[model samples]
Target: MQTHYEQEERFRLAKKRVDELKGFYGNLVSYIVVNLGLMILNLMTSPEHLWFFWPMFGWGVGVLFHAMKVYGFTPFFGKDWEERKIRQFMEEEKKRNESFKGE
Candidate 1:
């Protein structure tokens, strides 16, 4: 059986993992967004008949990533993986601290 200490430790670890993942992918997402808009503009102006395919394919991939991040309930990973875990950690910590102070 798990104890409170164990649960707290697990929560802390989960938050750390999410923070690390966010650090790694956060910038990548931004880069992809900026480059993607430019790519789309190019596709629109390009003379090649199929230049649009590249941005369309890239956009579909981006949306799929967003979907997995928001609704995914996986622990310590996936799209909303980090934010959700950190929010839970903060809420638990806040509650624990509040109870300690009789707040």
Candidate 2:
């Protein structure tokens, strides 16, 4: 059985994950909305030059990476790595606190 502190840590991690997902979704919505508006404006102004693709391509790459992070699609430095780092730091902090208490 997990302790109360461990449960709290799990809740915190879950909250952080939810927040990251929310931010990524918001980014995706903004990307789609703004890009569509830009495309429409481009079509209205200059249908021959086709300049909207530049910003769309660049911002689309950023959105793709953000989605990868939120969805855990990458092989390196993924959620497991993040959880391990968090636990490692928490252990270090507990040790530091114990040492301070002893002093």
Candidate 3:
């Protein structure tokens, strides 16, 4: 269990992380949507256009990568990922408790 101070600090960090994640998500949306619209525009205009296909392919790749990061197997969970700090604290707490109990 975290002390009050530790909890407060964690909350602060979490809020900051949430803000960062929101910004990241927004940027991802803009990139994917804009590029996709461009791809569609190019397609609708001229299917035989070579350049359109390449930019579309590039944008598709970027969208796929972003989608994977946002929804696929990511350790961060797309949020405030303080796993290392929390794990370290838990270990220390366990050790402290064991010492107290003379384990």
lDDT of each: 0.71, 0.95, 0.73
Per-residue lDDT for 1-103 in model 2, tens only?
9999999999999999999999998999999999999999999999998999999999999999998988889778887889999999999999999999999
What TM-score should be assigned to candidate 3? 0.45
Error of 1 at 39 (Å): 2.5
Candidate 1 residue runs with Cα over 4 Å from true position: 1-4, 13-17, 20-28, 31-52, 55-59, 62-66, 73-103
For model 2, the run of ten residues with the poorest summed lDDT: 71-80
Q: How far is candidate 1 from the true structure (C-alpha RMSD, Å)?
A: 12.0
What TM-score against the true fold does each predicted structure earn?
0.34, 0.73, 0.45
Tens-digit per-residue lDDT, 7-97, candidate 3: 9999998897677668668867887687778778877887687465576577667766665664534555533456777888999999999
Candidate 3: segments with Cα more than 4 A from true spot = 1-4, 56-103
Candidate 2 — which residues are off by over 4 angstroms? 79-103
Q: In candidate 3, residue 38 scores what lDDT?
A: 77
